[model samples]
Target chain A: MSLELRGLSRRFDNAQALRDIALQVDGGEFVALLGPSGSGKTTLLRILAGLDFPDQGEVRIDGQDMAQVPARHRRIGFVFQHYALFRHMTVFENVAFGLRVRPRASRPPEAEIAARVRRLLERMQIAELERRLPEQISGGQRQRVALARALAIEPRLLLLDEPFGALDAEVRKGLRHWLRALHVELGLTSLFVTHDQDEAMELADRVAVMQAGRIVQFDTPARILDQPANGFVAGFIGQAQRFAGRLTSQELIFEGLPLAPLPRALLLGEAAAGAGQGPAEAFVRTHEWQATPGPGNAVLRSARAAGGRVQAVFAVGPALIEAEIPPGLLEPGETCQLDPLTARVFLADTPFATG
Target chain B: MTPRPAIAEPRWARIVLCVLALVLLGLFLVLPLAAVFTEALRRGWGPVWQALSDPDAIAAIELTLLVAAIAVPVNTIGGVAGAWCIAKFDFPGRALLLALIELPFSVSPVISGLVWVLLFGAHGWFGPWLQAHDLQIVFALPGLVLATLFVTFPFVARTLIPLMQEQGRSAEEAAATLGASGWQTFFRVTLPEIRWALLSGVLLCNARAMGEFGAVSVVSGHVRGETNTMPLHIEILYNEYQFVGAFAVAALLALLALVTLAAKALLERGGPRGSLAA
Candidate 1:
């Protein structure tokens, strides 16, 4: 019941849309492909759905090769971002379309088809919209109809391409939760592509971060957030103020300050991190450092008014330096003193923080 | 609330411009129609009725209407298939095929008829083969129909191609993902979206087919009873010094064109609503 891609690649004339890549999803696993635009995430999903073929790769579902299988034969349900519900069809007809078009192998009797479609409509909570055309319904309702239409075929695998991208923020949030619950209830193997990090984080069992047609990190949401494989993943995962700095044996040296002194264990970890790591970088979660003024606190070297009367105050730390000030409290070109020791250190070349 | 003042403009100048435009329209577009009506009234209703009752004239008008009705749907089907091929499929010589489809529109109608004649005339290519098989074309009804078909083919296909291309491939692909078979996707999703454009294309094709004269005339050989179309009937009457009868026939065709136009509008309104309601 596992899906695997081996050496998948696709090229369009001068541009390589998908470089040689490989990935796997275990049975009933929900994996989200997260990437910026043109990173080839959607292309990979298309290949998996059999909508497009990779120039060089073998796609296997449950150990069965898909070389001879056309997209119609693959039995994979796909949900589109725009819903793509048949604008001319009522909700009931749309949900029934898949079943009605089924081949002899999986075709159900008319009564059974109707019952199945009704069940799916009930499941998606769109029975009331059964008679409504796609144009007559709201976007969210159309999306649900699209989902029901896809699910009615009883597909072995489900693929969703930015299913919530077109919706507003509030609808997106609710739909994400509903999709997660439905996935759990159905126990269906699913892969969805999304550019929104929050969507990937909140919905996927495993988030696969993509960049330049390659996966930078594939792990649980918390793991990827806490230990991003590279700077790109780190920056993509969460908000962290970073300062470029050099590493010392005992401390992170940045702006002439001994930032949070590294312990022996973390220093050893940093030393053994990678090759040519002299010009490494450090990052500090702004919420981690408390803002205070005292002689014991590090002196704020520079400050400027961020906006209106609010000020941004900068101070040096042991391993990293950051700015913090109350709104309209610190004026421009002012200095303040703050404490250090709450910063995390990482080798500049790589994105992994010193544990 | 206060009353607003009108914008400044010389009232006489506006009136004069409107009159000038009306005069231009009369000279260019209305005068000929007025002359046709006046000429028809010269012989009273007797010549008009006689022309309408003539077997040759009746056959010509019927054939024209029949050819238009048949050719329009054939072209509509061809248009949808051709549009889909150009929009969705990529194959070698696709551009050339598209160019060929549009060739009828740009090439001279006389040349188009001559080309068909060269292929099917008694002394032409395939002529002996068609004769041996007892198939009639070139100077026959079939030849007239074929010539009309050739010149009208591009009307529907051209109208539909750009619309289909602009829609992109997403909706159909999306339907495929939802487990719709090719036919279902076409009828339920693709056809519904393009129905309006399809109707418009059909109207254009029908209008062109009905009005076709140059290509049809060359191939029809003007066989008064068998091959003469409505336009040909009108021309024959005028050439025979039957001016009143010619104008009467012309008026009849004009009335048919008006009916077709009204039908087109009604179809456009009804077809789209039906598709949406489906």
Candidate 2:
């Protein structure tokens, strides 16, 4: 089902947890709420699930206002970050909990519940673990149980809070891919929260980038990568170095590096290209930049050849950033010409901008 | 072979600590318990059986059991509710409620009983109103039950709050999102999760309610076969020089304590699974 949120804000005593958040999710869509910790993405998910309430705003599922609905009545599934499985119950019982807890009039028969639970266990590929308690299963298997439990109620929207955050790196990759396939297989609309940018970019159809309790940008992963809303998104999403420079109507000049000013129109957009703004900053993703052995902008700290390709670490002033350098071009401690093929520069202060 | 850990305690220190702990347990626990049983049987099996069959002793046992039956379940329900409020939800005065639930622990047991007297005694706060209504409480079974309930009020709640807090509200939240109502989530999820700790709390509450002396004495009025609990009955028998009877009652209390300990340990070893378990 489609979900829409408008003007959602929640405050806990002195600190604001969420701020005027608004988003619309189409049915059967895979969305990612990508943000660092304490950015309020999880809080947003909780509010939508009716586990928490917004201090002021509206949440609608299929155009029904959700203010009066309780969490249990909302039928919005939530899988916790730590896999909140019932420790006392076996995997099958955990999956059966939702169905069994329904009111007597609507509750299914025991045989039906068992059949349904067994089917779900088989679908989760954890049929053998049905008799084992949550503690007996591996972390990955426990998450699968949690997911099956949430799905038992046939919820319209599934919300996962860092579902793979606790697993090892290799396991997290396999699970996310498997989860994505399951989402499509079941035609389930899911919104998962994660701080891992690569996970969001790799798994989500559209990512809502959040920072400091607000959604800064909501777009496709490629658009968010190519045209970030501000400097934070650009720096946060990709491997890059941040550098400040002066911008005149005709030329762009660096503050510390000895690089020549290029024409102003060369940057991404011409909307605010001819700038007369001072102290503008830009982030060039490592893949967007090329480096050669010559004195230009940045100093190469180290270069090593691995798997027949040279990868280098460059120092742009105090910060060290990595990029794939052309093979055999630069040595350690040598200055290089770091050229950004297509840079997006925003002026110092006409709009909301950052370093 | 796997290498030995570097952080293991030295052999001498470990041995000394273990010996010391065993010695302390024997001295403080085993000796006193053995003394009660030995003293009860000193006058032979006849006096011990006679003491056990005494009408006053039987009355005391009945009264103590009744008080525990009333107090333990009430306290368990109250404690679980209080712990649920303190652990699962945030509200105004939450910390204050937690501190207040522990008030019995800080207050002396005599004071806990005396407060009831101050409220229900003939000349105390609600005393006149109760008297006019032809109701008796301060020096009766109700008084004994109240005093025991007062002293043991914190057992279940104190045991549960920290465990519940450590277990967290996530499980309940998960159950709720799965379409479980409040009671369903609690009975199905929270209660089972905390069952071992809950059982221990009830066992402790029952023990204290049956064995309570200081508070029950203040409110009991020493009404022999009527209001006297097990501890009060033992005191009266000891003061009256009925050594065998007093020792017999003490042995029973000690047995109860041992049973509680055994049950507690058994529950822990075979407790519910997970690190977030009770």
Candidate 3:
């Protein structure tokens, strides 16, 4: 199903849970909603699944307005964060519930229902757990049972709310790969809500980064990383070192010291054109900053070999910057010159902050 | 290394507390139960059998069971609906609604019966219209059922609310998104999660309904073989100085209470898995 949302807004008492949210997902596409806690990503997913209704909005699934459709009639499959498997039921019975609850006129026979549940169990690799109660299985196995149960209904669209949020790191990595493969094999239109940026970037074809209640940026992982639209996206999506500087026609001045020349493309924007000389901020990824051995203003405070790279901290006056460098390239307490291989410059209202 | 001390408290204090508890149990619970059985059988098995077979006693037992049969199921349904409404949805005056449901629990049973009488008695609020419609509520089965319902109203709902609230709405939402209707979700997901609590509540309600004395006595006109429940019958027999007969019927009610306690203990021990078969 192709899903679209327009002007979605929801309020809980005095708090605005969602505000003027808009999004679109093409058929058979795997999209992910990524954000921190309380960012309204889960609320948006609930509205899409018809579990919640927006105060003012229109949700269209394949050209059909879902405003009047109840959740049962919407034919959307939802997997909960905690699995939510029925504790009293065996795995097979839990998966068969969707088919058995259908109206009698359209419901399949018992034999056919059993066959379909068995097939889904086999596909989810939980066939051996059919007779075991949910409490008798591991968390990962319970998750698979939940997925099989949701798939039994043959829904038009699938929604998952933090599907791997409760699992251990090792189990979560495996499930991410399995879920991506399943989405490809089934060719289902799936949208999953997650707070882990790595999981979203690894599994989704397109990622919608949400903050507060609105989608700040929606694009591929590479685009969102390489060309972030705002400061929030640039800081949130990856590690970046920010520095306050003054931009002029010749060079960018940091603390009255000329660091580098201003890029010509940055000077073409409306803000740059309106104020040719003003305070500006520059964001450079940790790996993009180089610490070359030389007599310079900056001193390398520390260097440690980690994750196949040397992570070194440098002190340049009051600001401390982190950079990833090749191992054994720089010693502790050595003076070096810092060079920015690539950076994004923006107009800042305040001084400077690094994270 | 030497072994650590095994006791948390001094040995004398533990012994004293244990003996004190045993003495209290014997004085309060065990003694009374033994007295009832002993007194009932003191006059020999013949009188015990005769008291049980008396037409009035038989009628009282039948009436008590009938009232339980009617009141228990009505309260169970109402309780489940009340819990579902209170726990699953948010609305204005929700706290007030819960307070109202718990109101009957805090009121005296006699006051509960009196309230019904004030509303449905001949000289009360709905009396004239009910009389015009040719209905008899007070001193009748309907009045008895109403009073019992009031006294036991909070059991099932009170048992279920905290449990249902803790379980939350995620499971129901999952069921709905999987194409199950509202009714299907309730029966398959919501009810199973609360089945054990519901059963425990119903058992308590049934036990109280069968043995209720204050409410039933006020509503039942003491009409022989007609309005008399088991407890009322026991009172009459005792007042008439038939000690053995009174103790015989009291023994039966005691057995019912014991059975209820046993059932509750079993259900609590098995916990959520107890109602899996249902």
| Top candidate, metric DockQ | 2
> What TM-score does chain B get in every candidate?
0.86, 0.95, 0.93
Q: How many steric overlaps are in each model, in order?
A: 10, 0, 0
Candidate 3 lDDT tens digits, A12-84? 8877888888788899999999989998999888888888888998898988889557788898999999988
Lowest summed-lDDT stretch of 10 residues in model 2 chain A?
A: A346-355
Model 1 error, position B121 (Å) = 4.3
Question: Candidate order by lDDT, highest to lowest?
Answer: 3, 2, 1
How many pairs in model 1 have backbone atoms within 3 A of each other, for residues 3 or more apart or on separate chains, i.e. clashes? 10
> lDDT, candidate 1, residue B222?
90
Query: Which residue ranges in model 1 land beyond 4 Å of their true spot?
Result: A104-106, A241-276, A279-284, A288-333, A337-355, B1-38, B90-99, B118-136, B271-278
- Local lDDT at B230 for model 1: 90
User: Would candidate 3 be rated incorrect, acceptable, medium or high by CAPRI criteria?
Assistant: medium
**Prediction 2 TM-score vs. true:** 0.95
Candidate order by TM-score, decreasing, is: 2, 3, 1
Please give, as one word, the docking class of candidate 2: high
- As for lDDT, the candidate ahead, 1 or 3, is 3
Worst 10 residues of 3 chain B by lDDT: B269-278
- For candidate 1, report its TM-score: 0.84
Candidates in order: C-alpha RMSD to true structure? 5.1, 2.4, 3.7
